[model samples]
Each structure stands twice: as C-alpha cells, then as structure tokens.
Target: MDRPVNALSKAIRRRLGPSRLRDVLHGVPLGHPLHPAMAMVSAGCWIASAVLDVTRSDPRASRTLIATGVGMALPTATAGLADWSTLHREQQRVGFVHAIMNVTATGLYTGSLLMRMAGRERTGRALAFTGLGAVSVGAYLGGHMAYRQAAGANHAESVSHLVPLGWHDLCSLKDLPNGRPVRRRLGYIELFVLRLGDGVSVLADGCSHLAGPLHQGRVTVEDGDPCIVCPWHSSVFRISDGSVVHGPATAKQPAFRTRLRQDGVVQVRPAD
Candidate 1:
C-alpha cells in the first residue's frame, strides 16, 4: 500500500505543483482545509435523498438530490485529494482507503440514478441505501484521519494563555549561535531563537502545519525579510512577525518581542 500510495502521491504532487490553485485547494486563504466544508454539500444531498426514500416522499425530489450529490462529489473529491497528497505516509494510506470508499459510493449512486432514469425505481432506491452505508464508512475514515492521526491539524501551541504577562528570561545571549536559529526553553513551551549580533528574533518552535520543529529549519531571506522554512513541509514564515509567506500552514506561528539585558541575558514575552 505504501509503495502504490507513494506513487500516487507523487503523481498528485506533480499535477498540483505550486500554484494559486494548489494554495486555494490547501485552504491557505480560508485558514482551514477546504475538503471538510466541500464534503458536506454532497453528504447533505445524499442524506436528504435517503430520508425522502424512507418516507416515500416525492420521487422527483429524491432523484434531483441524488443527481446533485453525484455532481458535487467531483469537486469534493478533488479538494480531498489535494489535501491527501501533502499528508504523511500513514495519513495517505488511510486517505487512500477513504477515497476508495467514497468512489464506490459515488459509483453506486451514479448507477442508481441511471436505473431510475430507466424506470427501475425500486432497484435505484436499494442501491441508494447501499451507497449511504458505504459513504458512512468513508466519513468515519475521514474523521479518523483528521482527528486520530492529527492530519491537517494546526500543531502550533497557542502561547498567550501559557506564558505570564510580563517579560521572562529566555537564555543567555551568548548561548544562541550568531545569525542562526536554535531551540531555547521558556516556561513549558519551546522557543525558536535566532541571533544577529545584539539583535534577536523569536518565534514558537512548533510549525503550525504539523508541529515540525522550527528551530531545525533553514533560514533564508525572501523579499529582504528574514524567513524560516519548515523542514517538514517547507512552510515559509517571516521571522519578523511569524506571518506565513507560503504554506501548507495557514495559521501564523506565534511571535515574541525580545530584548537583551546589560547582564547579557535575553528576555522575551508574547508579542501583543
């Protein structure tokens, strides 16, 4: 499964590449993954159609709903696949099976729609009920992948609540490598600290995309602004205020204001 999944992921990446379409699909503009919201459209239509079927309501309405759901599944699936392509191996495997289930359900619904058009309403209703079951399983798998595996979750810990209101000592100024990023401890949270002579910039160590350690990431200047690229997924963040320049990550990494004391200790507090 890993081998084939990897191959398929590669294909998807190649097709998607880096573009505005990919950014939209990744939900960078929306600040969340688009698939879950898109999925509800199709799911709602199918569920409504099933309810109509059980109550023996207007057959015409049921037919319309089934067709709508079938049509919407294409865009819903495209969004899900775009997100799945950027996930980890375990996540991709689960997403692959989830996609298979959805595809099966879609096929069943398509056949049911055709059957009803051919005057076999009873068989179509039966097939629609079966599709509901398949889609239910797929929904469960999608939830598992999103929740249990923490895929597509914002991994950066919010620091405003944890840290005290006042400035606190971070580490000795001498400890940080000059012009390079390094990890430092502050309270219960970790900090990604970079030094340039007397100046320092601080950001939360966890990558917002997947909690990839930002301290281990490489630094580069983009548009003359110092930026750090997440090693896990290459999310580029401006070090000045931790704003995402490029993503998989839509959420901003928490930034901090830093000052150096005359005694050679660095002090930091949450940027207000």
Candidate 2:
C-alpha cells in the first residue's frame, strides 16, 4: 500500500510542482477555501429546483431558477480545478472520484436545460431528477472532505482555546526592538511580536491565507496608525485592536494581550 502511494505521490509531484499547487490551494483573495463556497452555491441551486418542482410556478420563475443553477456550474468548475491542482496523491485519487461524480451531475443538468429549451417537458423533468440525485451524493463526499479530512480548514483556531487566561513570560521588553517583527514560539503556537516606540503588539505568526510566516513581513504604519503588512499576500492587521484593516483574510488573527512586568519581562496571553 505504502509503495503504491509513494510512487503515485512522486508522479503527481512531477506533474504539478509544489509551489503551483500551493497557490491554488491557498485561495489568496478569499482567505477561506473556495471549494466550500462553490459547493454551497451548487447545493442551493439544486435544492431550489427541487422546491420549485412542488410549487406550480409561472414559466418565468422556472426559467430563472434553471438559469441560476446552470450559472453556478462555472464557479463549481473553477473551485474543483483549484482543489484538484493541490491534492496529494491519495487525496487526488479520492478527489478524482468526487470530481467525476460532480461532472456527471453537471452534465445531467446541462441536458435538462437543453430539453427545457426544446419544450420537451417530460424529458427535462427526468434529467432534472437524475441531476438532483447526483448532487445529493456529491454533497456527501464534499462533507467528507470538510469534516473528516479537514481539507482547507483552519487548524490554528484551536490554539486560543487551549491556552490559559493568565500571561506567560514571552521575552524581555528590551529584547524586541522597535520597527521589527520577531518570531516567538509558545508550545505549538508561533507569534509575530512587534515593538513600537511606546508599546508592543502581537499576532499569530501564520498568515490566515496560506499559513505564510508573518515574522518575515514588513511593518508599516497605515493611515498614521500602526499596522503590519504580511509579506506573502499583503493582508494587513491593525496593532491597536488587531482588526483586519485589509484582507484576503475575512477572519482576524488571534491577538495576544501583552504587559511589561516589573522585572522588565514582557508577558503575553490570548485576548478574550
């Protein structure tokens, strides 16, 4: 089993370079994985069509719903391509199966749309039923990717819940210099600590976009306010409140509350 998996991995690595796969998987602008969103859209369209079947809607309404479902196919294709580009060998094997199922479903919908256009009511209804059934199966596999495999899920969100409320000794106040972002590790958590002239600020070291290391990022004061720019994707967060001033990141990084101890040591803890 291991031999086959290793051989497959090498083949995939040669076909899709590591860096190229990383870019697609990262979903740079949205911050979250694109596949989930596309899945939701596809699911919503099919569900709406199922609902429309029961209601004797006007011809215009039927056309609209069908159009929406057909339009959703574009993003579904984009998201699938992005996810497939990044999958590991074993994951790719599973993903290929998932993709084929979804493609079949999409083809069924396309056939349904054409039959409707041709005024073949009975045939269109049959095709829609087939497409709906395929969508249900595809949805189950998508859930497996999200919940079981944890693909495109944020692992770092669990870190804050594990730590105690009180401050832990980070480093001496003088150790971190002004205008520089330093990397510090606390257990499994890596932090990016920045020193200002009067105070210090800290954020999770990993970029929420693709887990890009923030320690190597640049510090620039945005709009006369202190904020740091992530070097990899340029996602910016404010120093004072840890709010995301700019994004690709819809979710803010976990910020740490800091204080200078009497012994000139700086202590840090996860903010409530």
Off by over 4 Å in 1: none
Q: Go through the candidates in order and give each one's C-alpha lDDT.
A: 0.91, 0.69
Clashes of each: 0, 0
* Top candidate, metric lDDT: 1
Candidate 2 lDDT, tens digit per residue, 1-272?
A: 44654565456445544343434434545556666776777668767776676575554555566668778877666656555544445555656666667888888878877887898866876887888888778777777766776555553363568777678998888888888889988777888898887587888888654466778987777788888777754657776666655644435678898998898888889887
lDDT of 1 by residue, 1-272 (tens): 99989998889879987677887877888888888998998889999999999999999999999999999999889888888887888899999999999999999999999999998999999999999999999999999998999888888877989998999999988888898899988977999999988899999999998899999999999889999999987888999999877777878899999998999999999998
User: After superposition, which runs of candidate 2 have C-alpha atoms over 4 Å from their true positions?
Assistant: 1-38, 48-64, 74-104, 133-141, 149-152, 158-160, 229-234
* Model 2 lDDT-worst window of ten: 17-26
After superposition on all CA atoms, what RMSD does each candidate show versus the true structure?
1.8, 6.4
lDDT measured at residue 191 in model 2 versus the true structure, 0 to 100? 87
